[model samples]
Target: MNGLDLGVVGNGTIAGLVNSVGNYQWLCLPRFDGEPVFNKLLGGGGQFDIWMDGLVSRSQSYDTNTAILRTRLEAEDGAVMEIIDFAPRFETRGRVFRPASIVRRFHVVSGTPRIRITLTPETDWGDRKLPAVRGVNHIRFNDGELAFRVTTDAPVSYVLSGTSFLLEQDVSFILGADESLTDTVDVITLDWEERTRQYWTKWARSLAVPYEWQEAAIRAAITLKLCVFEETGGIVAALTTSIPEHEGSERNWDYRFCWIRDAYFTVTALNRLSAMGTLEHYMRWVRNIVAQSKGGHIQPVYGIGLESDLTEEYATHLPGFRHTGPVRRGNQAAEHIQHDVYGQVVLGVSQSFFDSRLISRPGIAEFRQLEPVGERAFAVHDTPDAGIWEFRTIAEVHTSSAIMCWAACDRLSKIAAHLGLPDRATYWSERAAIIHKTILEKAWNPKVGAFTASFGGDTLDASVLLMAEIGFVPASDERYVATVDAIDSTLREGNHVYRYKTEDDFGRPKTAFTACTFWHIDALYRVGRVEESREMFESVLSSRNHVGLLSEDFDPSTGDLWGNFPQTYCMVGIINSAALLSKPWSEVI
Candidate 1:
């Protein structure tokens, strides 16, 4: 349960759908930015949501491999209405972004089920549920309260439930159209479930990555699309309101905002499929933010809509779901200076420079590959800020952060030369040397043969796996193997990888991070453990949700999900690991 109320269904834990009653009961809408119209999830206290409209059952499915959700709601009256919610994919736009928006289509099937949709809107973070009042075709909660209104052209009157009631559960329900114009005389035109299903089928055919784990990859690709912010080119990490680091613990935080690092990982996730459109659009936002002399010193996070003014406020008016307290909206972490994020962004785009798919974007396609990489690396070479941990504690120079810096410049320089970009060989070569010097000179303790989190921290870090994977050291390098062996011996709790012990460990996280798990796989592959690498890859994939979706963390003890939901980082990890495994299978089978 969460701070938002109502019984849970999808929770975006997997694909979501409501029972019957045509209640978009599970959606947080307007634009994933809007209030919870029917958030009977997060526990059910925020908005008044229930399936009390009628007596019947409901079921749902995805539109092929796409993020389109279609729910079939049946009525005791023998009437059926299919409710479809999808934010249409864009092939025409100059940029590739499918934000947290929804397009809902409702149509009737058989008997007339008394259709009821409650419009109890809440403001802020589900704090105030505005009372509903209807005037003309516009159903507004403007009785001294207004978040949004339900407007339609047809005649839907107040029914026994005190919510909008339709006499028939017909396909005639136009999502945002007036009921009077849409019903009987038919003022608006709309397609049924058939058209919606076809739309997804066509898009699934658009993906070109058809290797060993393509199905799982496609699901993640579609999930990443939903995580994107539509208006701006930003991509938020996940869409849900609350997921505790440990359930019911005070560790719950909202992740509806964008992290530069997370978005970068998303671009890399789609790299194999030539999803360059997504990266170009994302970089537009990146350029705008970094260039702006904003108050926050180029903070690591932003609002999905580029509304950088995200404030953290708890809704005091609404009761929390299952009584979980401090339900919040907007991320407070946005204000923090995360130095490591820069490396992640640089690394992701650098990976793109090597991506041949990027060869299609006009000037961007004709874009020079390597020189820009060096220039960007030069831009932040010595500027100290928050490291990758995004630690709430004081900032320090972390080894992993330094490694990414070296790796990013190294990879991007190669990509730039390969893609016909400015090479800046002297600058890149010298910078690479300096970065390498900085990392080894300041980050290592020779006695341990493992990297530390910061310049001198003694704790063994889960992040040390990056040493070999990022090419900071050769896979066979003694120090690199020692670091991996150290992690295998100490950092792992069964398969769970703790990012150092934290207060969030109500006990340690149950399952190893899916991303870190893949990190292990890649390390195993790099060090010549092909069978071990494949086994590790399979173990991580086995933890996916029923539909193959993954999250930021998992509980190894009970094998439940933790951290954020539908984590882009973990998905990208899967893509990287799967692609790596494909090479071996191609050699053999």
Candidate 2:
């Protein structure tokens, strides 16, 4: 597939991915799930790019503790230039100034250098490249319904003609709504840049981070926060979609929607770091989803705007990533009965009741709303449905899904008691006890010597490693320990782990799922295998790209990351593992 070596900058309302050479390869206007205006990441679509014409060497990184990207380009002639790109976000006049805009600053650091600007944007997912109407200091591109304007100090002729002009003074470009910029470009951009930097830095300062690998954990935390659409309190799985998990595997998926399974893991990690703002907002969203679920049947995923009918369809007009055909929008998995979501939804909201930092703690009404969720979990505790993997043609009584259901009931009992309801607590506790017994009896395999993927099946699934994670079983318990060993022997290839080895809808998976590897690390740490866990954690940390970001999966043989950019699950693994494995805070002092 085409490479996704881009850093993302977002302001909750909008996001963009800037390539190593300073091109916005993928960006959706208005919101994360909105139609793409720059579709070059999918191939053969319009893009917005700015780079030195004679650039030979380049390096890029996010400004420390912030999502702002800084790329330095050095030409062969010894001229140097730096590009500062960020979506302006900060507090102004007692409110957040998070507009649907991206501010870029071009600085000449050394010898005279010429630069080029390409502001071509395709309307309606690259169906056509719309033309721009230029003025003295700004240019406007419209698709009839919406208009995208670029106001810059650079000459319009030099930009349109792709002609390089001498870089005498620093230039700033503001890409936003179609409104005139009355203030000077440098003045407005500089102010926003400073405010954005301070905002992110202060946010990072509030995190209760581990001493070792603090930077990695911080970057992962910031990236996860960027995935949140603050307006709706929805968190996307990843920034860019349609990037395949493996080569020619047809495992490509659009991760722009929020999944209960993924969001649960994300909030769990943020909770460990004391980042309660995201958790509070996410719980608000989860409360709504739980209320909307009819008879406790929750979809695995939903649009950021909470749109339910995400029917999958292919955008065949544009070539797929790296020309892999059948680029898809919407998701078919939404239709499947992924039972793990009920448990995940409960787990995500349970934290609000205990976290004092949350603006509003869930009380009696929220507990009443969750009754249907526990009821459905108990009803389908042993029933068969699509597992977490979302196998299209096969259905089985997945052990992991059931375990999640058990967790749902287990947490419900505690939440009920927390609300001073003794009878309700006893009701949920009884259901949880039954589920606990059923999982131990039906899911455990005598010959395999551990819990299998499904009841009465011998296939091993690495997700079962979560037995210790979700408190389904104690790490010291022989059954849980034996299950970890079973997964280690069957699914682990070197330090990495695969979700499963069995052939499924597509075929055998060839790469290691990055998050599963982290699960293994956390499992080891939980079981007191500190030495081994540390070694494995270091190995997985090395798997990140140059800028310390991870995708969904990785090729163990080649150490090349594959799948969506800045995957929420994979990044959560980084934060969770670091928090679990890091030495005591007293030592750092």
Candidate 3:
């Protein structure tokens, strides 16, 4: 059965998800948001499968500190085989060589193992199957203008016919573009694998990870890096799309594009680990979005290539994940009036103005470009629109949006002071103060004994905990502590936290929003409940899939992962909580 326990292999340009038995369940070719060449994860008919006849046992894991995955399979007759999977990524000739390819190596460990290889690819969301054209040593699969070839050392006739053959020696399969290989399959595969391993280890050595939970932090960091589209620097929210938040909920939506709010949290978490490369690339993407906006409105989400019109549509042909219907392609939130985007735009780029380690630091001219964003934030701090949750029908002056708007002005004030512009600092400072005062007066609900989701509303929301997170309110503040207590009492279930109990267009949420639970844990630690916070953190960490990966939502009752796979928001939670809750290196070292 398909599950989220799958391991991810990527080279920043392309990615693939492999199950425990070494099946390519999901893979997007050409790019991250490109066509799904292998769509079996979403209940489609296309997948790359390697079946061990009479298999009895199997296990899968990643190479230490790297995205390379190895799966071991053993048959009843004592035949053993190991499969190594990865996307080729390494520095060569003064530039990073991250190709749009996946490399698979089949190694015989013990006896002669009979293996059957099935390579099927579908296009148009699994509605059309590509016709195969065979060659001397390779097979080409083409549909319309799209085409890719599998160059392998195995017999071409056996591969095309899905015939089971005796694997007496090691073999290699390079699934990539239609171009032919320059070298032999074994030579290039071995060389690329070694270089990729070295590149990942070197990158991992640079992370300033916390003392405790080092493994979890490293895995999450690498997964987050995989989400980045190296060509454009836009980080996707997750790899797969239309995986429902819960079973049969019809809450499925596409997460393959870059969301402004999600990108801010992603960059902030990576920044904590001193992974400044991702932040720099993402800042360039943000700057492009701002320039395209021309100091006007900004969408909450956009294509990684910066295409604006993300009109939502359903792929009627492909059944959703786990046979749940309604697999969606594009996101409808692009047209939403998500006013908080203004604040995210400013916050996402704020560090560039202050961090001297960056090669190109932002100056007065960059600040001038960002001022209009802050002005828009100040303009809509109290206006009604979709909150962070993106409610379709209900619109209110959401406290979370207001607080982010405040954050925009507050950070701009600090950036102005950093650039030695006292007058502009005062200007942004005064605007921040006004927004802060208004939130305190209107967002707090004395009737509920906490700050609610929206201004003048009595309902509790998990997002209000950001008051302490974004520095809207100090952790030591009485109201902030009280709000944390109120949310803890209301939204928490076991170790998981729900966004809210209120009903929306899709009815009530049935599972915990994985990232919100992390926020609750951080709030607990900030409020001097260290022991309880650590306990809750461990409990939530236990819910991660076998490979230490998380999705967007989790069911505390069943401990099953839901929503999109390898969610960037949930991975950011792992990085952030590990950083905050881990003991200092001085104590351990």
What C-alpha lDDT values do all the predictions have?
0.59, 0.88, 0.91
* Candidate topping TM-score: 3
lDDT string for model 1 (1-589, tens) is 1221111122121222243333444455545554665555454533322232465777665656766566677767676677665543443346433323234455666665565554454554455565656655555544332244454444546421356455463322222322223332233224323443454566566766647887877777777765665456777676665655556655556777778777877877776666566776676676566556231245678876677777777755544434565567777777776555545655656654454555433234423332343455545545555666565555666677667667656765555455555644444656777888887777677777777767776656677677875677889987777777767776666655666553332443444566777777787788787897787677778877655667677777777776556677787887778877765445546
Clashing pairs in 2: none
- Per-residue lDDT of candidate 2, residues 93-183 (tens digit): 9987788899999988999888778888887666788788988988898877768889998888998777778898888999999988769
Per-residue CA lDDT of model 3 for 1-589, tens digit only, reads: 2378789999989888998999998998788888898998899888799999889999998999999999999999999999999999999999999989999999999999999999989998889888999988788988767889999999888888899999999999999889789998888899999999999999999999999999999999999999999889899999989899999999999999999999999998988998998888998899899889887788899999998998888898888788996898889999888888988888888888888889888899999889988998999999999999888888999999999999999999999999999999999999999999999999988888899999999998998898898889899998889999999988999889999998999999999999999999999999999989899989988988778889999988888999998999999999999999989999977
Regions of candidate 2 where Cα sits further than 4 Å from its true position: none
Candidate with top lDDT is 3
What does each candidate score in C-alpha RMSD?
Answer: 5.3, 1.4, 1.0
What are the TM-scores, per candidate, against the unseen true structure?
A: 0.79, 0.98, 0.99
